[model samples]
Target: MRRHLDRIDQLILAELRHNARIPVAALGDRVNLSRNAVRQRIERLERDEYIQGYTIVEHTAEARANVTANLFVYRTDRMRGGEVIAALKSVPEVVICDVMSGEFDLFVRLEAPSVDRVRAVWQQISMMTGVRDITTTVTLSTVIDRT
Candidate 1:
């Protein structure tokens, strides 16, 4: 069964999403609760799986300058899909991966210094165990990254 969140629980989640490192005292002030109360609520949220562990987003000049590429992969050998996925995960060039339905079995997102580098990565992927066909799209500008 799924659990329903109340208004206070939703408020806590929203505030945490904005800044996970926000101190309990500050969070309490914003939510009109005591520090201990806020802490308890946060703990409950974690226990209930509403709150996952916090993460940090590191932004570097190299990351900002790199070109983002999306690759759509079609696998011929469905049985070897797991091996192909593991190989993709091992490659540092692959930043994101997803198993999809339809023509392509896997979708990958990567960052490279140039378009040529993206092509090289695609070639490497194509040579991997299950990869059959690859199509790529280079992103010109990112309007939104709702991560």
Candidate 2:
């Protein structure tokens, strides 16, 4: 079962989403709660898994979302789908591999740490036994991403 969150709890979550390092007193001021009450609620939020953890979002030019690419793969033998997918499972950069219904046999999404790594992932996919042809497109700029 899931726990229910009240309006104040929702407000607390919103503030934390913006700045996870906000102090207890500062958060309390925004949420209209005393310091101790805020601390207790935060503890409860953590214990209940509503507040799982925090992460740093690096804004540096090189630190943006690594490199994302899409690969359209053609296969020589359509019967070898399972073997190709199983091989891709071992490659960490292979984020999404879906069997498609057109000229291409598979549509793949890759997220690598660098452009070179993205090319390497594409090469790896190409070398698979059943793969016949491949077309790759790298993301130049992400206009909007909700994921």
Clashing pairs in 2: none
TM-score of 2: 0.71
Residue 75 of model 1, lDDT score:
87
Q: Candidate 1 — worst ten consecutive residues by lDDT sum?
A: 54-63
Off by over 4 Å in 2: 1-7, 39-60
Model 1 per-residue lDDT tens digits across residues 24-125: 999999999999999999988888888767777766876678888999998887656788898898888899999898888888999888888888888899
What are the candidates' C-alpha RMSDs?
4.0, 3.3
**What TM-scores do the predictions have?**
0.63, 0.71
lDDT of each: 0.87, 0.87
lDDT of 2: 0.87
Residue 1 Cα positional deviation in candidate 1, in Å, after optimal superposition: 6.7
Error of 1 at 63 (Å): 3.9
